[model samples]
Target: MPRFYIAQPLAIGQLVSLPEAVAHHIQVLRLAQGELVTLFNGEGGEYGATLSDIGKRHVSVEIKTHQPREVELPFGITLAQALPEASKMDWIIEKAIELGVSGVQPLAAQRCVVRLSAERAEKKMAHWQGIIASASEQSGRNRLAQLAPLQDYKQWITQQDMHRRIILTPRAEQSLADWARHQSPQAVTLVIGPEGGLSDAEENLAIQHGALPLAMGPRILRTETAGLSAVAVLSGLWGGM
Candidate 1:
C-alpha cells in the first residue's frame, strides 16, 4: 500500500486533502477514487483511507479506519554525531533513521572538516529533515525522527540530560556490553566523532557530563557507521528491532 505522511493530526471520519507534494505523487501514481492508501501523522498512529475525489489541483482522502500503532524503537537512542563531509552526513542521517534512532545531533568537533554558517546550517538541517521523513515513510515508521540543529561539542555537552550518556572511544576499557550489564535506562545518548574523532579534552568534558566511554569492538568504525551500529545493537538488546 502507498504511504503518505501528514504533518497535521488525523481524526476519524474526517476528510483531508493531500498536501501539494503528496498530491503530485498521488497523481503520478494514477490512483483513482476509492483506492486504498495509508496515512500517518508522525505521531505513532496510522490511518487506512480511500481516495474520495481526485481533482485537477487537489486529491481528497476520506478516513476509513484509524489504527493506533506504536512503532518506536524499544529504547530511545540519541546520536550526537560529529560533523563529517558533505554527502557523508546525509548518508548517516538516512541510515540512522532506518536503524531506528530517536534523534540525531550534528556536532562540530575539534577535527571536523566541514563548517556550516548559520544559513548553511539551516539549509542543511532542512535537507537532512527531508531525508529523515522519507526514510521514515519507507521504513514504515509513523513517528518521524528528530534532527537537531548543529552544535559544537562543548555546547552540546552542557545541554544534554539523559539516563545513559556515552562516548565511543577505542582506548576505553569499558564496552557497551560492559556498561549495560546491570542497568537499563529509558534513554541513551551516544556521541561519535568526526574524521579525526573527538579530542582528549572533549572526551574528558563528555566524561565530566556523565558520558561513559564505550568501546564498540576491537576494530574502530568510521564516524558514519558507529551510530547506526550502536542503534542496531541497542535496539536488539532492548527488543526493539
Candidate 2:
C-alpha cells in the first residue's frame, strides 16, 4: 500500500480531502478509486484508508482503520550536523530520517564551505522538511523527525541540552564503537562537523560544555558519512535496528 504523510488531523470514519501535493502524486501514480492506502498524521500511528474520490485536481480518502505501529529508535538519537557543500546536506537529512534519528540540527561551523543567507535559509528549511516527510513515508516511520532551524555552531554548542552530546573527531583516543559497546541505550546528540571538521577551539569549547569526543574509526570519514555511520553502529550495538 502507498503510504502518505498527511499534515492534517486524521481519524477513522471521516472523509479527508488529500493535499494538493499528495493528490498530484496519486494522479501521477494513476491510482483508481477504492484502492487501499496508508495515511499517517505524525501524531503517533497510521490509518488505513481507501480512495473514495479522484477528481481532476483533487482526491479524497475514507479512513477505515488505525494501526498503532511505529518504527522509531529505542533511544532518541539527534544528528547535529554541520552544513556541507553542494546538496550533501539534503542527502544527509534524508538518510538520517531513514536511520531513525529523532531530530536533526543544522549547524554553521567553522570551515564549512557553504553558507546560507537569511532568505535562503528559510527556503532551505522548508525544502528539508519535505524530505523528512517523504523519507518517513518510505521508511515506514509513523512519526516525523524534528528539524531544527539552521544555527551557528558557537551558540548551539553552549546551550543546555537535555541529552548527552557526543562529537565525532579524529583527535579522540576511544572510538565510538568502543564507547557504545560498554554503554546501554540512551538519548544522545551526535555532532558531526563539516568538510574540514570542527576547529580546535570549537572542539575545546564543546568539551568544556560536556560534549564527549569520540572517534568514528582509524580512517577519516567525510561529514556526510560520519553521522550515518555512527547511527548504524549504535543501532547495531544498542538493538534499535
Candidate 3:
C-alpha cells in the first residue's frame, strides 16, 4: 500500500478530498478507486483508507481505521550540521530522518563552502522540508522530523540547550563511543562541521560553551558521513536505531 502524508485532521468515516499536490500524485500513480492506502497527519499515528472516489480533478478517501503507531528514538537527537557544498545536505537530512533524528539544524560556519542568500535559503528550506516528509513516509516514521532554520555556527553554539552536545572533530582525545558510554541524557545534540571541518578557534569556543569534543575514529569522515555515523552509533547504543 502507498502512504500519503495528509497533514490534516483525520477521523474514521470522514471522506476527505486529497490536496491538489497529493491528488496529482494519486493520478500520476494511477491508483484506482477502492485501492488501499495509508494516510498520516503528523499527529503521532496513521490511518488506513481506500480510494473511495477518483475524478478528473479530485481524489478522495474514506478513513477506515487509525493506527497509533510510533517509532521515535529513546532520546531526542538533533544534528547541528555546518552547511556543505551542493546537494550533500539533502542526503544528510534524508539519512538523518531514517536514523530517527528528532531534528536538524543547518549551520553556516567559517569553513562552509556554500553560502545561502535569504531568498535562496528560503527556497532551500522549503525543498529540504519536502525531503523530510518524503523520508518520513518511506522510513515508516509516525512523526515528521523537525528542520530548524539555518543559523550561524558561532551564534548557534551559544544557544544549544540539549543535555548532551558532542562536537565531531578528528583532533579530540575522546572518542564518540567513550562520550556516550559515560552519560545518560534525555536528549543529545551532534555538531558536525563543513568540508574543511571546524577551525581550531571554533573548536575551542564550542568546548567553552559546554560542548564535548569527540572523535569519530582513526579515519576522518567526510562532513556528510560524520553526523550520520555518530547518530547511528549513539542510536544503537541508546536504543534509537
Candidate 4:
C-alpha cells in the first residue's frame, strides 16, 4: 500500500481530497477506486483509507480505520550540521530521517563552501522540507522531523540546551562510543562541520558552550557522512536502532 503525508485532520468515515501534488502522485501510480492506501497527518498515528474517487486532477479517499502505531525512537536526536556543497545536505536530511532524527539545524560555518543568500536559503529550506516529508512517508514515521531555520555558527552554538551535545572532530580525545556510554539516552544533539571541518576557534567555542568533542573513529568522515554515522552509532548504542 502507498503511504502519503496529508497534512490534514483525518477521522473515520471522513471523505477528504488530497492536495494537488499527492493527487498527481496517486494518479501517476494508477490507483483505482477502492484501493487501499495509508495516510498520515504528522499528528500521531496513520489512517487506513480507500480510494473513493479519482478525477483528472483530484483524488479523494474515505478513511476506513486508524492505526495507533508509532515508529519513533525512544530518545530524540537532533543533527546540527554546517551547510555542505549542493545536494549533499538533501541526502543527509533523507538518511537522517531514516535513522530517526527528531530535528535538523543548518548552520553557516567558516569552512562551508556553499553560501546561500537569504532568498536562496529560504528556497533551499522549502526543498529540504519536501525531502524530509517524503523521507518520513517512506520511513513510516508518523511525526515529521522539525526543520530549524538556518542560523549562524556562533549564534546557534551559544543557545543549545540538549541533555547531551557532541561535536564531531577528528582530533577529539574521546571516542563517540566512550561518550555514548555516559549519556542517559535522552535527547542528543550532534554537530557536524562542512568540507574542511570546523576551524579551531569554532571548535573551541563549541567546547566552551557545553558541547563535547567526539571522535567517530580513526578515519575522518566527510561532512555528510559524519553526522549520519554518529546518529546510527548513538541509536544503536542507546537502543533507538
Task: Give lDDT per model, in order.
Answer: 0.87, 0.96, 0.91, 0.93
Best by lDDT: 2
Name the 10 consecutive residues with the lowest summed lDDT in model 3: 157-166
TM-score, model 3 to reference: 0.96
What are the clashing pairs of model 3? Answer: none
- Could you arrange the candidates by TM-score from highest to lowest? 2, 4, 3, 1
Task: Give candidate 4's error at residue 122 in angstroms.
Answer: 0.9
Ranked candidates, highest lDDT first: 2, 4, 3, 1
- Per-residue lDDT of candidate 1, residues 30-72 (tens digit): 9999999999988878999999999999999998898877678
In candidate 4, stretches whose alpha carbon ends up further than 4 angstroms from where it belongs are none
Residue 171 in candidate 3 has what lDDT? Answer: 94
> Cα lDDT for residue 26, model 1?
93
Task: Count clashing pairs, candidate 1.
Answer: 0
- Cα lDDT tens digits for candidate 2, 11-72: 89999999999999999999999999999999899999999999999999999999899999
Q: Whole-model lDDT for model 4 versus the true structure?
A: 0.93
Q: What is the TM-score of each candidate against the true structure?
A: 0.94, 0.99, 0.96, 0.98
- Candidate 4: tens digits of C-alpha lDDT, residues 1-241: 8999998889999999999999999999988999999999999999999999999989999999999999999999999999999899999999999999999999999999999999999999999999999999999999999999999999989984845778999989989999888777888789999999999999999999999898999998999899999999988999987
Task: Choose 3 or 4, whichever is better by lDDT.
Answer: 4
